[model samples]
Target chain A: MVVGFAIVAAWELVTAAGVIGFRRPIYNALALVGNMLGLAVLFLMLNAQFLFAAQVIVYAGAVMVLFVFIIALMNPESDVTLGPARGSEWMYGIVFGLIFAALLGVLLVNQGLTGRSGPFTPEVINAVGNVQSVGTALYTTFLFPVEVTSVLLLIAAVGAVYLAMRRIR
Target chain B: MPVPAYTFLLLSGALFTMGAIGFLVRRNPLVVFMCIELMLNAVNLAFAAISRYLNSLDGVVFAFLVITVAAAEVVVGIAIIVQVYRAGRQMDVDGLDLMKE
Candidate 1:
């Protein structure tokens, strides 16, 4: 398990860096696809079978396809130049990243996982099935949020159509 | 023994930091959006890890919801980006400052 985790972790980091470091938008999109796939594998390792599926289908499959399609359609130019005024922006970005990482490290080291354990242990989940338990919880405990999310999705769909239609008209 | 939860959290934090840096440093708006997705994925990783460690399904469900929201956001955002591109606007986030005036 340790070796597997290490391999996946390395893959995740490399692909993530690719997503950010690639000059071309298409390459960035492709790198994100790889990163999402690595994340899906991690979800599986964490015993989140449903999340693994969702991450694969939704993120790697649907979302990345959209990104690649848009990149193809727009054919955006690679960011070759830093521009005259914005050249130093990356230095600030690096500094901010260092500080943010340091804070997270301190928090993780100081205060570890302190949350109360719940009822769904691995044995229980295995008996009930991972997807079944998650679905029941979603409908029972999280029904309201699920309904709201559906409404939000509907609104987003309508908004997207409206935005696209305006250009046609 | 199984992998520790803190390791997962650490990886998530690193990925989030990278995404934040990319969001700030990248000039292209599309890349910025990609960085946002990276950050969201990192959060999802933490959620799943914590959920497993805590023996709860809440984090998994929450991660699922986040995936849904991200999909919706991407659809709308990409549509807007396409519109902007069609309008002949520059693709750089720094250059698109029409609202400032």
Candidate 2:
């Protein structure tokens, strides 16, 4: 388990760097695809089987396809157009990044996970099936949020269509 | 032995920081969008890890909701981006300051 986690973690970091460091938008999209896949593997490792599937199918499969399609359609130029207007931008980024990392480390080390444990342990989830339990929670305890999310999705779809149609006309 | 949960949280933090840096340093709007996705993914990872460690399904469900919201956001955002591109606006985020005036 340790070795597997290490390998996946390395893959995740490398691909994440690729997503940010790559000059071309297409390459960045592709790198994000890889990072999402690695995250799916981590979800599986955490026993979130449903999340694994959703991450793989929705994130890696559908969303990334949209990103890649947009990149292809727009075919935006590479990072060459970015003149040295903000030369010190990266230095600020690094400093802010270090501060954020330090804050996260302190939070994790200090507070840790203090929440009361719930009923669904790994063995229980395995017995009841990961997807079934998650679905039950979704339809029961989380029903309101789920409904709201569905409505949000509908609104987003309509908005996107409207935007596209406006461009057409 | 199983991996410690803190490790996952740490990785998520690192990824989030990288995404923030990318968002700040990258010039292209598409790359900025990708960096946003990276940050969301990192948050999802932290959620899953915390959910597992706490023996609860809430984190997983939240993560799922996040995924849904992210998809919707991407759809709308990409549509707007495409519209902007079609309008012959500057593709760089730094250059697209039409609202500032």
Candidate 3:
């Protein structure tokens, strides 16, 4: 819990204070990677060891590397491109704010969002909701989706390679 | 007093919102990419918390898979960003609309 708060607070403070310019994509990306590691620790607290490993290996490690790579490659100095949406979004933001407030109000009144406590014994792996159980459930009940995940990933991979491929001059 | 899972979730929620707003409001491709990463990390926080509550390991594993996917996203996104910048001179989303007209 402390770790979670520390990470979030650090980021919120840093960004809010403009200690590092928010427009600096590198800092934002770096902060994002740090945030992912902090969340991985949070996962450990949740007793999701496998998830923690995945988070560290995949998100903090791999995905972030890719994000950095993209940042380096994108060349932020290209001709001025997308317009800042800042001025125009205020009206829509009010609607979003109201919706967020309404949702939080409902959640607070019902207590469903904050009130859940799991009967999470330390040895929950044997009790239930472990990797094996999830695998069994996925293969049995959610087999189609499991297979589809691969298909979608493959499609994405192919598309990426194709898109990134050099054009034949 | 020690913080709680709800606090993490709330913080995660706030970070995610920032990312979303940045993605929408920031004109730079890099910022948009960073925003997307922020949202993904928010989901990771939720998964971790729920996994802990459920006393299950699968959620973390799933989160790992998500991380892997994120890595892949970086490779491709960077490649495209490079290509786009090479062809043009900027990283704004609007600059790539040569296909539309």
Candidate 4:
């Protein structure tokens, strides 16, 4: 838990403060990759074995690849600078972020959002296996959402292609 | 002893807030995109924590869907960013005001 928290803290610092350097977004991407890997471990601790694998494969692997590719395409040396935030913007970001954190922290301390623990306890997960249990629930109760997810992916692909394509003369 | 779910939730909140701050403060489109992903990851962590605490598989399923959607979002968002960069030769979010007279 401590290690994971540290990794996440480092990720936020590098991404938000540009601890390595402001111009090097590659380092930020790497930090994100590390953060994702840490989250995967946290998922494992939660008995979300399937999600752990998926997070590693999808977020840490594929999504990060896209980010790195775009960052590289931006011309590493020439357009590295993405412009610094102005004084007021920094102040706003800090104020909003701190307020958000404080509010959520208070809520957690007050036990406001802790829902009743359900049926899939650690014992149940061990008995049925994490992957099988998640697959069962996903296909049975959540089938419609699965279909919507596929359609969303299709639309995103088409939109990306359309945006990237040059207009025909 | 196993860590409490609230601990994970708190970390998630921290991450989400940090991402929001980055989104508000960063001028680069790509960094902004990364910040958005960071927020999504925070949500995933929270989902997993709640799902575990609730003793249901639903949270994992939701997080799975979120990861998939985020992948799609990255594809399209980066495409748009690339297009904008091609046109303006700048990655600054303010400089993207193509509608300015």
User: How does each model score on TM-score?
Assistant: 0.96, 0.96, 0.74, 0.88
Worst 10 residues of 3 chain A by lDDT: A12-21
* lDDT by residue (tens digit), candidate 1, B1-101: 37988899899999999999999888888999999999999999999999999999999999999999999999999998888888888788888876676
lDDT (Cα atoms) of all candidates against the true structure: 0.91, 0.92, 0.61, 0.78
- Among the numbered candidates, top lDDT falls to 2
Cα shift from native, residue B47, model 1 (Å): 0.4
| Model 3 residue-pair collision total | 17
**Predicted complex 2: CAPRI docking category:** medium
- Prediction RMSDs, each to the true structure: 1.6, 1.6, 4.4, 2.9
Two-way DockQ contest, 2 vs 3, winner: 2
Judged by DockQ cut-offs, the docking class of candidate 4 is medium
Q: DockQ for each candidate?
A: 0.72, 0.73, 0.41, 0.60
2 against 3, candidate with superior lDDT: 2
Superposition error at B39 for model 1 (Å): 0.1
Ranking by TM-score: 1, 2, 4, 3
Predicted candidate 2 versus true structure: per-residue lDDT over A36-116, tens digit per residue: 999999999999999999999999999999999988988998887666557877897889898997888797777567889
TM-score of 3: 0.74
TM-score of chain A of 1: 0.94
